[model samples]
Target: MMKLLRLCALLICMSNAWLLQAQTTDSISKIDSLRIKQIIQSGSTGKEDNNRNVLLNAANNTSPRDVNIGLPSSVGGITILENDLPVVYFFWPELPTTTWRQSVGLERTGLLKMNQVALTMGDLGFAVNSYSQTGTKEFKFKSRFTTSHYGWLQGDVNVSGPMSKNGWTYSVGAFLNYDPSTYTLGFARNAEEAKIFRAGITKYFDDDRGKITLNYKYTDSYNLVNYALFNYQTNGQVRELDNFRIGRDSYILSDGAVRFKDVRSGEYYMANLTGNEVTSSSHTINLFGNYKLENDWNFKFSTQFRSSKAARILLPPLSIFSTNAPAQSGNTYTIASTGERYEGNVGTQLAMNTPPTPLTTVQGRFSLEKKVDNHFLTFGLLEQFYRVNQFVSNRSFFYQTAEAQPRLLIGPNTDEYGFYGYNLGSEYHNGIENKLSIYANDEWKVNDRFNLNYGLIFRNHIVNGDYSQTPRTPDFTLQNATFTDINYSWYHIGGSANATYNLTRQFGLMADFQYTEQNRQLEGYSLPEPARTNKIRSPLGAFGIFYNNDFIQLISQATFLTRNDYLSRFNLVNPVNASEAVATTTYYDIQTIGWTTDFVLNPFKGFNLHYLITLQNPVYKNFNFEAFGVNYNYSDNNVLGVSKVLMEIDPSYEYKKWKVWASFRYFSDQFANLTNVLYFAPRWETFGGVSYKLNKNIDLNGRVINFLNQRGASGTVNGAELVTDASLYENRLLTGSYMMPFTVQFSVGINF
Candidate 1:
């Protein structure tokens, strides 16, 4: 088609230009041959800037070229380029083609399509998106048409240039964006998602002898999620301790402690945690920037101003307690009492009049980073001002959720709210997060055959929220049992490092380690919870060799890793002396060690092969109040296997005429999982696709995703419906839940 011919023509021209550039590079360095280089490089040997810039440009190809002066697409066919091109950085680059840039801050881009490979400087870096994919839920059944997903579109381009004439190096950048809005429900339901458009301009100032910049961002994000989305909803999500898997039907939990399991390990872990609804709105304009002094040190300063609001809410009337459940014949009991113990046994849900919920949060962060010849370091301070309509509710609720039922750890009683009650409307949170981090990285180059990259990151966080026994409230006002009318803080520090050292032209070793220590901290409890130190250390590594010729290229890697998880709930009869009375009813920990391998093969320019393998040893430590359970601790270990393969083919003979890409995976993680109960993950999630150039101005694309049948009447004993799975899925008992039928979408892009 016409599109193919045009693409082929561009390729030919680019190929010729490439030859010219190559010949030129051998002749003389492009930018360095000029004046600027002699200064920045001072007296360096290698005058390489053309190819360097080209390669760097390719790595940063995220922008699209503009067509006209300042108007929308005016051509009926294809548009022309008039402005700068986007720079993109790909994980792997075998083919030089144009793909749309993802959202500003998100890993996924927008759904819009464009044919012209015009690259333009992207929006300012701090812009947000205002679109969501909240299907049947957002519009309700009547208005619902098709399911949609949303993302916060953020990204910026800062082009700083050095002017030796005026001894000034200036950076001019701008940010434009639209961010989505979302809301969460209290129980087992999902929240609604929306979006808002924001725009801002920022400019920096600096001189070659010094580095300084002053920047500001102004934005108004509308249609954000608020109290309305929370107070009323037909169905919501659930709250639990751990291990909840049901696929799509799984509550679309965001930040909840429990959630559905993906097709990864045999069971759920942190990677699978969801079920939190986030809804925020405000006008934020920050005049913030940084500067570097002549002493090789940097001093950064900034001040932010903002207006924010939240929806009104009622405090739920429920209390959590650790009491003996009805004794069954087979049930085990370590305690003599058959009676239940509670922190708040109030029988009634707060029977009070309702008023709209309102709260505000204003915060700021300041930091400094020092650049060492071989290291990069930074430290900072944070502060936030919060004003909430009700402090009593916010203070008491955190206390109960963190302590009330220190024994069962989790059960129906805990779900009802508190450890034993259901009303949670009473707890409100208005807090700020302040944190700092210092990090350093080094790229070691010994010779042409080997290279190594090492880094270390350290950080600390401080959070402050308001609490009061007699805070302003329309109803549900009671003496807060714990720290009412006082401010508390939680502090934690974590660090991580990754290293890669090449042994040969195509072979090397890589490793990473991260540690987080958050002990001696108090969480939200009916009373301040016990302070205990917990640490998580994870290390990952891989080694591989590659063989390559023009016709065929192959790579194989051996990957290994280890991870840890820990959780402990405390029980205290007293409201204040939390540290001493801590029963330490349950101390949970999970440790895992595993290995994985990946292989990628390219027989030709248009075709590629990809594969992966993973093996692991996972152990879990568990304890619960049930007498049948061990009062001490028990660790369960299991091994699991996972593998995958991907393929893509683009015919050179056809030029840009027709393109096809397909990926299939054979994955089985159950072998290493220890799940005899509860619904787990799927065995596989496959993908396939094809895009053809019907003509020069129009192209067609189609895809069949998640080919395997996972939504069958499978998995759990009772037949459960697939929640938000793929379009086409096979339902198998014990298998994961299926989404919908098959989903097929066709998009068209035209360039004149």
Candidate 2:
């Protein structure tokens, strides 16, 4: 068994280092021992070094490790390694920033509907670090610029080097970004712009034992536009739905026709309105430090402070009425109706000088890590403090078509029903939380033929808070009601355990188990209900086996998850068959089981292929919940937005200076909502691109994304505004994320 293991390791090392012509025997001996150690433990390291190189100008002596051993980098890149008899050479140019990694990966290969346009922007950045005197005094610097066709731009510069001859190192970095194409759900006359600024400074002590960093950032962003309901006559004429009839006789079927109902159905339409401009700003300061202690121990500490202010504005996207139209006009539709619409009144209006929301927070963390022989230990503590205050008023106007009910009028002379008006309200909160965690792991070599790894983490979290809010009343006056104060406290414990064992030279087995609990306090908006604790418990376990060789690898895993006390969103609905909406809370239990298989093949030089498939079954188990004072059952139903099957394939080929690659993804049909009122059909997508390295420091690339341009009904959404009967008063249009059309993009950059 020992001989077999040594042979397998030797074959893998030879194929990766010598077969690729990456390093000669003499050069391989000169390679840093640290680099070789990382490669042997992780199987891959140079690819991750590319991403780490982009984060700052200073190049780390050790390469970063990959999160998932066999997965591709979030941002695509190419790597080349070569070592002569005296010098080692490596180049990895295509690196994605922290932000671009998430956005770009999803745009090109994500399965769900997403804002592809917002995420499709391309970036170009590179850096080089050289160590003189055999890795003693390193000097490095970098520059980057990114832009999109939609009026977005980002640029940054970073530098790092020895500050003095006394063994002190320093790094400086700054960045500026402007984006005028921030997308909004609704239409806007002028697109809102977002601006950001960031700067950081770091100092390293002698012998690389300790380091400190200070960073500052500021951001300003805008919200989306607003929409409203309108009344458009069949003659292509449009008018605002602002006026209502006082009696049944005041409305007629047509112009001069006999009056039968009090309202008209065919006249209602919807239109986008220029929403008020709302801007939010945040300022943050961060200070961090790390120190290495004796006996292979390490210590880390960090603190962060943030201040944020929001514009004095109402959430205009949530209008009084929904986008859906009604089924029946006043007369039970003597005339054919267009469809159901969500219109509460002729028009919805906002009050000026709404209170702005202000927030301040402070966060701190401390951790220590130590390694004693084959055992590793870690402990950490975290603390957070937060404060928030806000006052707001949203005035919705509805001409009283029906007689004014008890205290329905806003004023004595006013004959309007503010059915959707959220009267003067305020929220004040002061919250704090503390958490402590400890973890230990062991890597044991039981024998020449067997290796084992096991670990576990234990954590506790405690939270306390004081919150208050004003109840609603008639006249939309704050003085009419008093503030209601509430206090909350909770504690929770969580843990995880994992184990891995080697069965043979090329075979391995692994198992992992996790248990978590959380106590959350839900904010209250209604008078009867104050903030309440929402307890959640989630437990998960997984078992897997894998076979790895020099040229091919295969892994299969099965996972089971159970959520015992899951909290749902706070739903607002009209339970009394009224036009107003009331809030309610719901909870459920869910269970899921999933199986995943991954395959990687490198049958020949300069060619690679990867395939992954996942089969999952998620359902609402023993789900019984209440909404608007009514109980409902939803046991054994498939979870919304969770597909039964998902698949992906990635293939790439490289020869000489040219590289070509393609990505394919597929998702099975799934339900859009819990009620199963709408469903989405299966979708398949393809993306292909080509890259050419003109030279070591320069490259050009082009991609044709969304090649299939698959388009159809993606999914559906309930009306923005909840009503008594959704079928009678809600719109039924599928409103999930829309697929991006076929697009072509090109990028070129240099690394020196």
lDDT of 2: 0.40
Model 1 weakest lDDT span, ten residues long: 31-40
Q: Tell me, by lDDT, which candidate is best.
A: 2
Off by more than 4 A, model 1 = 1-192, 202-421, 424-431, 463-480, 484-501, 516-565, 568-587, 622-634, 637-658, 665-675, 678-682, 692-701, 712-741, 748-752
Q: Model 2, range 1-752, lDDT digits (tens) per residue? A: 35323433543343344222312321342200000001111121121222111211111101221222111122212111100000111010111121121111010111110011001100011112211111113665545455544434545544555656765555444445443332222233233334445455555655677665555656555422222222322221223323321110111111111101101111111111222214556675655656776545676655555555544232221123321335214411111122232233321222222223444445555566675554455555544444443323223322221111101112222232222333322223333333444444444444544444444444454444443344433334433434544445555545545444557777777665555565543233322245445656766677887777888777677877676645443323343433433334455677777777777789999998877777777778776766556666778876665567777687889999999987776667655445554445666656678999899867777765567865332322322223323353233211123333354445564444
User: lDDT of model 2 at residue 138?
Assistant: 60
> Model 1 — TM-score against the truth?
0.46
- Please give the distance, in angstroms, between residue 383's alpha carbon in candidate 1 and its true position after superposition: 9.2
Clashes of each: 120, 8
**Quick one: how many clashes does candidate 2 have?**
8
